[model samples]
Target: MDSSEQQDNLTESSGCAQAALFGPFQLIMKDGAEVLISNRRARAMLAMLCLAPDEPIDRDHLSRLLWPGRFEAQAKASLRQCLSDLGKLLAAADCDLLDISRSRIGLKAGAVRTDLSDLHDLLTEGKYLEATERLVSIGAIPLLDQMNYGEAFDDWLSVHRQQAEQRLQSAVSVALSALEKGDNLSEYARLSSLWSVRHPPAQTIADRKQGKVRIAVLPFKSIADPADHGFFADGVVDELITSLGQVPQLLVAGRTSSFQFKDSDKPPSKIADTLNVSHLLEGTIYRQGEQVRVAVSLVDAESGFESWAYCYDGSLDDMFAARAEVVQAITNGLSDALKLTEHASQPRKLTSDRKAYGLYLQGRALTIRAIGDGVLPTAIELLEKALEIDPEFAECWTALAEAEINMTVFTPCLDRLERCEKAAGYAKKALCLSPQQAHARIVLAFYAWTQNDIIGALDLAFEAYRLEPNNPDVLNRVGSFLLYCGRSRDALPYIEASIDQDPVNGRNYAILSGVHLNLGNIEAAVEAGQRMVDLGFPSLWLAAALAVSGDREAAIETYQLTKKLMNTVIYPPAGSAPLNPDAMDAYWLMAAKGLWSGKDQDRKNYCMVLEMLHATLHDPCDSTIVLPAIWMGEAPMVFKTLGTQITTANFFAFMSLWTNAEPINRVRLHPDFMDFVERIGMVAAWEKYGWPDLLPKPSTII
Candidate 1:
């Protein structure tokens, strides 16, 4: 029968019967009374039918699954008894929810409303909003959490559960597309946050090719008095992972993913299963003053057995040699254990001076942390000291450059432009010494973008990607630069690839969100934004996305949260404060008020605050007024603000403004819009690449 006919039959026969397949299995009848089926096999049969509504399962197959080890006749009898008992319970509840035939049985189409069935219907109907809402309410609870039959049924259940998860993910994607098309920002944000909470970005064994050997290097335990040498052990592991990652044949788990299991009491097999690796490498470090002892072991994740083991002893005076010995031994051990042909290349020493190398490690670790007061400044000091000790330490220069660039964001009181310039100098020095420094190239790319050299930025970014194709940071930088140049379609693959490699990095998600947002994929944008928030990254971009998506309340709340985080958790160094604290406070206050009110006058008030802050800070390219002016429907103010930024050769803020959102379209529809694009060099970039997803070619811009 057609769907409508089935619906009519269901309405007449199944009175108020609903099946809850997600979480604990429940069959609720009329008046919210749940029908209790004490038979596990009966419940499993019902679940199978519910999952495949309207699809018949063979009686033989069902019997085998329900009674795996029993004789065929016995299993058939058991299945018949279970079916009879289930039918009687349904009859008592006044529900005709089953479709039984001579040789097959199934749940009748539309016989009983189920969360899974409803989700499928909504998704099929292209009603992404409702589908997303349903998913949000369902809240990550797996299908039939309490029901497990025999081995056959359990295996069948596992496959079906995986299918359910895939369907839910598909619903999320489709809903994001629908929401993007409808421009429903509020629901988009809500749904995206739910998606983030439900599905964090992490790679599984499925991400690797079949038969590929994957491994995770767990953190080395430090067996030292006071445990003060833990950082040293961590640094050793970091270098070890980097060295192993260079072996093209090995699929190494990312440091972020591996470090998550630090001090975990879980067994090697379980940890390996979680990390989706076939093998694991774990070790220990013992330090007494300058003297150290290191022991390492490689374990087969399946059996949790030690495949190989090694030990090394060295003093801090010969740390580099010791680290090289340890790395070589591990690589050789892995090669023998896994029967690999390819070997890891020789380790590249950052510096010959042990003190300088140790200092560099400490500084690099702090730079990677990149948060808390005085952290970045302390890193910079240590890096500088390392450089002083070894003037030709190219890696130290890169570390310093990274630390400097981070200062612009984490230590907001520092002069941003000055930091960029310093970063540029350090990056160039590093590049001069070692031309293949992808990190240095990435730093230079950002510096070039800040200096309004879009083409130069793109070139540097692409060059870095070429140098380090599998490097997540390089991939993210390339994607981010492409995004800034209004190339969201081109940026997506790189962003996705980066996420695949380094799923936990919040900055990756931030860029991913921006790419989706500019492409008008509101659901995906919000999803990435939520992930960014979860990763403890700045939520300002997410707030902006919510604002544009028409979620004013969420936008304001996110903005306020971001402001609070900046003031409290991400404060500047002790000696430095904002040059104009009152203006800064007023700036945040007015922005929040405008976002909350969403009124023209309130937005205009925010524009005034931006102007005041601009004047107070002496920044001619005050891009802060553009969004407020757009919100105020003051196209002239938008043009004026953008024109000032263009005149001053600051194209950094223009990246986010090039969109077809209603607020942004107001700026685009202005008579001078084409002239503005021409002046900003976007016309050239678009011509060379392709037009933005939402915009017309310059020739078509009437």
Candidate 2:
């Protein structure tokens, strides 16, 4: 009712004005009419909602409160009918039900007026002292005084009561923040994040930019037909797909989506089209004596061409690496389109450090943990200690430097210049002392990459690969570099080598997914992507990969999360380069496009693409360590000189460790960058780095 209206006399009449009385009974009134409810039990129920101004009261607990220990079933039925009748009584008198839910007895706040609400609202609005005094008179009602008398409704009441207290406290907190002279912004942000985590938004992750790849994996036919080996076939196929899908660029199909057509004798091209893919992969599993023979083939959809194929023969004990071999072969087949930079062989040094070398390699192996979880400090400590004990141990020192570099890449708490220099020192020392050592060269290349010295990074990377082609680690690194240069076709051999070396590793899986997706093998990519996610890898890669597979639903949750936590996607300390610049545009655009494989899902994961692009662009310049970028080919566009963005015109040279071989930055300083950016009407560049920052910014690059 409008408070400014002409005063209506407070007297009984046919036009009811619903007013719930607390003491011992319930009554409804509106427009001067009154409906007095004589039952104390019903009134007690009404009192509960009246006390809670805008909160829900559970129905389960209401039954127990009204009837105490008796007539739960009948009382619930009776309560529902009574509430309905009460609703009509209030409505007939022109009262509105603010919220009437089936779960609990809730007052349509508009339908009635209660003194308790006035007090609560007053307190919530910062009149705490006045509200406290009002509570006394309101809490004394005979029916309301029996609130905590029963255990039946205790849980629900306890929950709501706590919520109310929290809301009240939150209001007080907001008011206090405003009143305080100095702000505690960090603390406030942290607390809000805590609350957000506790109760996340409707979407956990945002949509990713979709790529096209509808890939699938056939369930491996078991040669071990005995029921005891029932899990073998499924495990191998899934493992292969899982390892391959870890690359966010692929659109690997899910097992459920692929296995349904398993063993159907479908031709590779036919299967590829059925799955709406440009490429198809087929494999078979067989066991002979103690050895397992696994063969796989990659086929082109257009010409029904057999692009590539390979087979592995190993003992049952070696099954762990079987999937990697298959993945490598498929990647190899698509080598023409996807430049996978990888080495040709593994290191031949049959040496181990007392107790330190094994642990050192193990430590090196654990760097850059799956999404969200940073590498353990213990791993870094172990690598550092190993190096200390064996200063002459070039590999150990190299590993330590790499670890430090990775820390800086993940978070700038590590000194970028100092760490990269130290990494270079260790890696160079290793190379000088052990010229033939592939791992040593790899270390040097890593440091060079950090310094934005593209040529130096590539030279050392190739040397490492030539020296140890079979080393999966080296292969993965080389493939990553090739991918960065847009020489994806050249990257295939390296990735294949790595996968052939260690198929089960998530890195290899991720790499394979990218290779398949780039080759337009949609089915292969999706299968690989889903496999990556299901096998305990981080959801970010899987989400992005699956999003590329046209399954936007799977990637949607994580994509939403990626946006809210935008910091995760944007690298810190990008210096003067704002993300929206044209010089950085291609790197961001192309990489973003390729990173996600499925068209539909990628559309859903749009934020991920942007953040990914931002991270990719920023990481090359801002990153002190290039190993993580190496492991995740997302660093291609991010590569930059230590201090400057290189240009395409000067593409032939490399002055630092962080620069792209192609000199992509020059394009940005060209007319194209300004024209394109102006059209987009984006001011992000202005916000981060003004126009002057890019103009004649040549000297700042390196």
TM-score against truth, every candidate = 0.62, 0.34
Q: Among these predicted structures, which one has the highest lDDT?
A: 1
Clashing pairs in 1: 185-549
User: What's model 1's lDDT at 312?
Assistant: 83
> CA lDDT, every prediction?
0.70, 0.47
Mind sharing the TM-score for model 2?
Answer: 0.34
**Off by more than 4 A, model 2:** 1-376, 410-414, 539-555, 558-702
lDDT of 2 by residue, 1-702 (tens): 111110132232222233333222234443343445444445556555655656666777666666576677887887777777766755664656536566755654365554334434664575544443433233212213224436655554555545644564565456446434346454443333222221111111111114423345566666753642434555456445544444334445544445546667777666666555566666676876667877766667778776677677788666543444545554544443434343222222212344465456456555534123456455677777776667676656656666765655554342455665776677677666556666667656656554445545555665565454334576677666554443344456666555443444543565666655555455775666555555544334444445545665655554434433343345434343445545344443433443343343532354344445445543343332222222223223323221243222122122111122112233333444444333322122221111121232221122
Q: Count of backbone clashes for each model?
A: 1, 104
lDDT of 1 by residue, 1-702 (tens): 112322432343443566777655667664555677877778778878877675689999999988888999999999899999999988887888888888999876666777677777677677766666665455434566545567778788878877776777787787777887889877766666455434411222234334557778899999876735477788789878877776666777777767778899999888877667788999998888878888989889898888798888878666656677668777877777788876656465477787787788889888988877789999999999999999999989999999998876555542667778899999999988887777898888767666556556665665565455556677677666667666676678778877766666666776787778788888788889888888777766687678778888888778777756654453422233443666656656667767555676876677676566545544444344455555444566656665554321233445466555765567667888778667656555554344555564432222
